[model samples]
Target: MISGEQRVDPELTTVIESVVGGTPCANSGEFHYSLAERRWEWSDDLARMFGYEPGTVRPTTELLLSHQHPDDRATGEAVIHRVEDGEPFCGRHRIIDTADRVREVIVIGDYESDDQGTVVGTTGFYIDLTDALEEERNDALDNVLPETIAARAPIEQAKGILALIYGLNSEQAFAVLKWRSQHTNTKLRALAARLVEEARQFDPNSPGARTRFDHVLLTVHELVDPAADAS
Candidate 1:
């Protein structure tokens, strides 16, 4: 029945008495939609992940929704509606914090009941996902092995040039280039595939002979801005 911007609930200072003495309150908000009287508390780590101030967040349901990605709005609302229907709920969404930076989160809640065990409320938790997201992304990046080592961008373009010039698969071309680097104890991407192309251009019978004489110039062109290459 919270039809507008009005909030009428117990002051957070009262019910959180257990931690009131020495608890470092960062950013927190209490919600009382019906009979549930609960306050959500976040640690300093959580606040940092959401980019919020330690003492200045109002922490309303609307604020949480505002942080969601536009595409996720309906899904998030549907989840909330389902939770209000008395089902145990777990959901993940993006949220913007006090600093206006976006963050990922998983919200979990269950039925709250009175002493008689009658269900009276539902309380939820917001767990920051910045660390988890970064870890997952890094893990995916790690799976690429050598391509990941070279940051993919440079190596992809370098692979394209090699595939075109040597009539070899990109993987095979990269492997040959890698073998050369390992034999010479040099960074694989340092010379890029242009060096290999130079070797291909002349002296096909020589082990390390190259003729392009401008490996540096071609490498610069291939490795710079792989994104624009897609364009």
Candidate 2:
């Protein structure tokens, strides 16, 4: 069932787990595959991400494919083929965990090769985006109440503002806002409320409000895109 052989890199796993720990999304893991042996290796976090006990199961491409949501299997196989061809892989897919819960995930990886330029393996990280995906879907559903729409209007506006200012897509913008909410020990809605309120009071021509707004912008940028700051 394994599309190809893969193996886990312990050092890479440790590094990735450490990196993910400080992010807004903690449900993520690192994976490696060995093309020569047709084997797979998974980090403990990756194993648990798929609802498996760490080291309890021998990882394989087939096993990973089996956990994918039925409709995503073809895309998943296509990703594997790309990896085998020594190309970088980036895709969003759905996985049915052992608990039978369908989780949305984003996987990003690159090939590993030797001096001869032969692709030996691939490595990457999978991050769970189920909560965000569900929220977006719920917002789009027609069954929502009028009051619910009214309540979400300000938050959606705030998200748009963040997206525009930060050059982020809607989901990443919301994630940045959510991360700020948690880091500051504020309720998500309450924090969003403040964002809206602050913008409401802004006087575009006044340097004072602009300076204050700049502070908020800097704080959000720091949290949401620390990698950018690092560079």
Candidate 3:
């Protein structure tokens, strides 16, 4: 458990909550894995997502891998191995829950360090995108336009950054970018451009990169020039 001084920023937490709440089809929750202890901790929502009643069962790496779709089990195991080796953990894959329902999810996390500044584990989010996929497919079909091709470059780059950091597919990544654009009152292209520029400086391998990127993603809108967008 995090101490008061080490707690995440309330505003940042609110932003994440809003993002999860705003979408009816998206179910998301936080998780942590302690490297030294080889232990897993799941939020109640995550437990529910796995078709288990909260607090009813212990979360373990083996339990997590057992839930992976047969075809994706190797991929899931590799992600855990990478995290164990002190690398960022990011995976977009499918899993079969206790109810025998298949769900697609994204696991995005970064290294967690102890008070001594030693990397101790990993912490991040699990985002279920099963229902959202159909919605995004319909939106994609409706929005394709020849004229929009010119603006796709930076937007695509921004989407890639979001995908890598958040473990979202291209569609979900675009949805996040669009959400930020609308809420921040920033033009979509301008917002994407700003995000791409800022992300260029982010090094995923660096210590504390995940927390820093979270701040950047939440507040980058403030850095965009409205007048420039207007032009």
What's every prediction's RMSD, in angstroms?
22.2, 13.1, 8.3
What lDDT does candidate 2 reach at residue 91?
64
Query: Which candidate do you rate higher for lDDT, 1 or 3?
Result: 3
Counted clashes in each candidate structure: 1, 13, 0
For residues 1-231, write the lDDT of model 3, one tens digit per residue: 222343232432443465476553238766667778787777777888888887899987788878989998886787667656656645667889999999987665556677797988766667787876666444444443221354567787787677556555565577667756664568888888888788779788999686577667767788888885786
Per-candidate TM-scores read 0.38, 0.51, 0.62
Worst 10 residues of 2 by lDDT: 221-230
Ranking by TM-score: 3, 2, 1
Each prediction's whole-model lDDT (CA): 0.44, 0.60, 0.68
Candidate 2 lDDT, 11-49, residue by residue in tens? 444434443554544477777777777666776777888
Best by lDDT: 3
**Measured by TM-score, how close is model 3 to the native structure?**
0.62
Q: Lowest-lDDT window of 10 residues in candidate 1?
A: 10-19
For residue 24, give model 2's deviation from the true position in Å: 11
| Preferred candidate (TM-score higher): 1 or 3 | 3
Cα deviation of 220 in candidate 2 (Å)? 27
TM-score (C-alpha) between model 2 and the true structure: 0.51
Ranking by lDDT: 3, 2, 1
**Candidate 1 on 1-231: residue-level lDDT in tens?**
122333322222232222122354332222333345433344343445456654556444565466666766875775556445544454556666657666565444444455786866554334444544555344433443455346545455555544433333444335434433433335555546445344345654565322232233223334433444333
